[model samples]
Target: MKSVEEADYVIVGGGSAGGVLAGRLSQDPACRVALIEAGGSDRTRLCTVPGMVSIIHTTPKVKKRFDWGFYTAPQPHGAGRRIPYVRGRVVGGSSAINGMVYVRGHRQNYDDWEAEGCTGWGAADATRCYKQLEDWEGGEDAYRGAGGPIAVTRSRDLVPATQALVEAIAETCGVPVVDDYNGADQEGVGACQMNARGGRRYSSSEAFVQPALARPNFHLISGAAAARVVIEGGRAVGVELIDGDRRRIVRAAREVILCAGVIGSAHLLMLSGVGPAAHLRDHGIAAIADLPVGQNLHDHLFVPMTFLAPTARHRGTALHFLGGMVKEAMHKGDTWFSRTVFDALGFVRSSQAERGVPDIQLHCLPWSYPSPNQDRPVRPVVDKRPALTVMPTLIYPKSRGEVTLTSADPTAAPHIDPHFLEEEADRRLLIEGMKLVREIMASPRLGDIVQGELHPGPAFTSDAELAAELPNRIHTVYHPVGTCRMGVDDRAVVDPQLRVRGVDGLRVADASIMPRVIGGNTNAPSMMIGERCAELIAAAH
Candidate 1:
């Protein structure tokens, strides 16, 4: 019943970016901010527990409650298979359901952004923003953050098998054992850093928005979904929101930012009539701006290679039973995350052509099972059984996909085409990447730990055989980005400062604006964008 006209800033989508913006902007007592989220609150039992990382994305009851659960329009290279897509529909967005791994990606990823017309987003600027937002368990260094809202702790609860796996990777393979991948040396085996603290998940909403909610100027609408921008006199004046049974026209005296994430943000832009003109006309929506809103859709793709777990006598912790029970009881929720099977990770070069750059990421988990059917979420875990899985991820894929509308209805899910493994070069890199894992597994010491190869069995020795298996196991790493890339080029959707080109009083601050997807998980960089974008907006005012 409160009037939205009283607000100076109206931020659509209270996800990763909007949450931080709402929190930072309202610091000025004179400014009033409103954050609108389509989904319900993120304050749920599943979201708070760190161990729910996998459960939040896989479990039927928990996943549907917070995830968008959209599937890609069949991938041509993936046996024409339709891949399941999961985007968060809660206040914290994907951060609520994503694996809590806290990776800042390669430092060069930001440097590349600067080369690609993103003016101030070079490695130097990005590091500053990251340091400002994180409270790393590792003490403050030039690169790591300190005294920040989000708690980031390095993996300390790794199973003994996982520790040996990391050791074997360094000793047998050429890769070194790195203390921190986010540090100066990015190439090597290491424990993953997590956006966790005392075995609890810390989403962006919890990191930035929670403290700001106490301020009188900050307002949040949990179930209000933005339909379109109210453009008048060639300027964004407000947003048309569908609030349950009523339509609300919320005015923005200063600015309107869309942080609906990669898929949602691009969908909203096309709905607002600001994307490719031909596509806009096809949807019966009047074109407001002709920009590439959802054309360059790219994501990190990975292939899982499962192997038998260490033998019964080799398995020391009884399939990680003792650690799981103790942590669960102490945390008041299942602590399967603390005893998380995905403990060991590695960064390596698939080829020497990309010198000084690690193009592939290897994640080793101490468990294995087939993926859940297209309908379910909890990543398949065989109860009480121990196994090992080495996943080779193509960090920098050349193939691009797209996101478009099926209808004008705002509630309908957008059509997504990730175009996974469309490029032959991507196939070649990952095939070689998997070979790296095969080499590690073939190590004499590693041979002592495991029973036998599970998938692509030991007899499938040739590259031709393993390459043939990729189509079956390939899946999204869930790091979709670049639908609304930021740049100074003609095809750019938003400028370096994140303001939408040709649109006054409008900006985009989310994963959608990434010029090129980062080399690692997207959660950390998304929050970094949230932090720097707030500074940019504040400086302009």
Candidate 2:
């Protein structure tokens, strides 16, 4: 074993949260900052090009370079089979591989955080943190930011099918199209905003970390996979790592922060013997603290309701030498299904009767697929025949699962169990959401473009038929959160300050600390946590 570099802040995971945290903390030239990423650089061919997103997402190279490609334990309520779960392992993390959809979730989400004992995290104060990071294309407003690091653009150059879909959703829901979902009204169909610049995907590494690299005090190390945090008399002092066959340690003088994401952070803590006492003993590890390190896992669940439309062919991009790539920014890549895959989005209430808050999120894709099988990861159906897939997701899920250690080996993947639709309420809402999407599909504006239903067609009409089909039909919306949950409770792994409970000089920042799953996509809020963590740590100095 060899002791390597030392820094004022030793940050684990050069991911979404870690990138932002390092960028903010290193602004003070006096402090030395280091960010370690297990994966390599973010400048890959597929990652850099926006239109090649599908190839990157579904290819074998994904597991090797971009994603961790974790698989879930067999879900009982699901098809009784393991589901493929993808988490980013690169510089920008999932922000590198995601759909580039920029959703801040609802104001009620952060307010709920404050109400749950996370002080100074209400929507108003959180908005201030957002303004400091966002460079919104929609211009400045009370809700939108104008001059910030991340460039957020509301999608333009929509296909005619997407326009029809949005119009149809509005007609069915009786809500007008609101240009900005991140703005005041979040309950209508509109072009989804993205973290992009001139039609290119702009990940957090590009947005934050790249700028801070100019400072001599800040440093980034790729392929430095963290093995464990060194705890000296209950204070986290450094991070031990596996660099090839050689062993190394990067000591921290001020704080050792864990931004290893929901699964990665919690898995590292357990390996360091800071998880459930009995569970740690099973892996032949001594317990540092008998805390619930991995619990309260939740995510958005959706079922792709497929439809065949002859009118969709008109909006489909034709393969041409110069006209391919679809986006106005790129001209030489493959023709994408649409300029933005998730060009149109909708928010609706399904779980509860309340009109103000939405429990369902609708992702409208202009291309279609055949009847999906349960053996593999879900991908968009690719064919010349124009089709559409409307995936209605249960934003607020009741089902809970966990991430547990398979062994003490840091290289071994953790056992992930999202337990999809385990609860009866989650199952009920899944049916309700699917039904609502069907109604929107049957509406006149969109129905005018329809050919027929390819999945759950006219034959499977009853509620019972749809309910029975859920085990094979439903899939993840790819938003996993709440593993190392934060609260003032006993089961909480981190406190409201994000400090790891029962330890000093250690804090967890990322999606893992979410007390409850927010009502929308989680990337934006995860970045917000990074901003807040930086402020809190700077205050202590």
Candidate 3:
């Protein structure tokens, strides 16, 4: 045991949500806050590039330092293949290394949370928080907020295929094109709104953390891994951090906030003896409280349905490079290549006929997209040919999984069992989604542009074929949630205000607390959670 320094608040994990919370809480000036991050700073050039995210994914130098590099336990549903789970280890967390798509999801997704024991977290309640964090470049309205820290802009590098897909889907499905998916209605095809400005990535850390670093009340400690929450008599006191061979304990006078993400946050709670008693006993850790810490893991599973386009107009790999150049030249009033290459995109409900909410989501990229398991090409080969890639994601999965401690060590990654494709319905819906993608691509509007299906080829046209091929092709959308779920029920890990039911002065403020995963990209919602958490904590004071 070491002498601990006390602060009004101690926040674990200075990633997406934590960054916002730290910034907001320390704004009170009167309160001293300490934000501990397990990774280093986000000063790398790789993190700033909006179009080069895929390049970073394949590079070992960046991956080794910035990524947690976690892998799931062998999934029984996916035929025993271990799913790779990448979480951001840097100051911005996953937002520092994500695709940068800024989606708020369907409003009903949050309303459903209120229905499921999260009383004040309904769409109406949560949207305000979402609005507060965004500085929408498209301008402000009732749905979007202005003068906020996080810059949300439309992508500058939209490819032709993406625009074609949006137009095709709208014409074929009769789903009207929406200008903003984060607006009045979420179930439509339109351009994807992203967290980009001036052709650069705007992560939460960049938007929130960087600015807050100068505040005297705010203390940000990077490279400090929170080993466990220090609890005494069922209340969290602070946390223990491991630095080299030295252990340091820090105390929080007010509360110990856990924003360690779905996997990290839940693992810390369990390590602090806040999970299932039987499991805790087996790990040789005393159980302070028995709760379902990692019982309800959920994620959106996706299968890519690629298409080969006719003519050399598709641009393929050149689109990213050209898009960058067009953006740069456009800054200098050169619009020569602007109209020829578009970054247009859209989203639609997977099953529009059966829908109360959207089940499938689509993202179009103008390139010869490869699957996650595919090896990177050794050299950049421009196929002076047309190509397009459409990714169909299963948004609201019926299948559920769990995360378990492989070892009691806090540094060790947990066994994540997402159990993808376990439910027959999930598989059936995915097949339908794939067919929908094919239909959208084959629409009269896009038919003239596309040559044929490149993946799930013409040979495997039937639903049975899709079912057989999907298992081998499917990968995660990287939107895992519900592990440290929030609800009033016994199985719930935290309550409506995000406080651990059996414990005091501790709460989870991340995607893990989501009772159900949102309908679209989760980065925006995660930041909203952080913003909302700050409000909730401020109210508590």
lDDT string for model 2 (1-541, tens) is: 1223999999998777888999999999998998888888887646655656666754575556788879899888887868778788888888887877788888888888899888888888788888877999889899888888888876675668778888888888777798888888678879888777654567778888888879988878778799999998999999998888887888999999999998999999999889999999999989988899888999988887778877554223336312444443353322342235676788877747354788788988776633334337454434446677788888889889999999999999999999899899889988888888888888877756777777767777898888888888777777889888888889889987889999899999999998888888888888888988999998888
Candidate 3 at 272: error in angstroms? Answer: 0.7
Better of 1 and 3 by lDDT: 1
Better of 1 and 2 by lDDT: 2
Write the residue-wise lDDT of candidate 3 on 1-541 in tens digits. Answer: 1123778899999878999999999998999999888989887766766655555676677577888888887767665667778899999999998888788988988888898768999989888998899899777888888889988876553455567677887887677878888888877777667787765668888888888888888888888899999999888989999976887888999999999999999999999999988988899989898898998899988876667775323443556566756675556422312121214445565543244676678776665555544422422233444677778788888899988888899878888888888888888888888888888887887767788887767888887777777876788889999899999888998888889979999999998999889888788899999999999999999
Q: TM-score, each model?
A: 0.94, 0.94, 0.93
Off by over 4 Å in 3: 1-4, 156-160, 310-345, 350-355, 373-385
- Each model's lDDT: 0.80, 0.81, 0.80
Deviation in Å, model 1, residue 146 alpha carbon = 0.7
Q: What is the lDDT of candidate 1?
A: 0.80
CA RMSD of all predictions: 2.8, 2.7, 3.4
Which window of 10 residues has the lowest lDDT sum in candidate 3?
333-342
Candidate 1 residue lDDT tens string, 441-508: 77776767777777656766788876776776687888999899999989999999999998999999
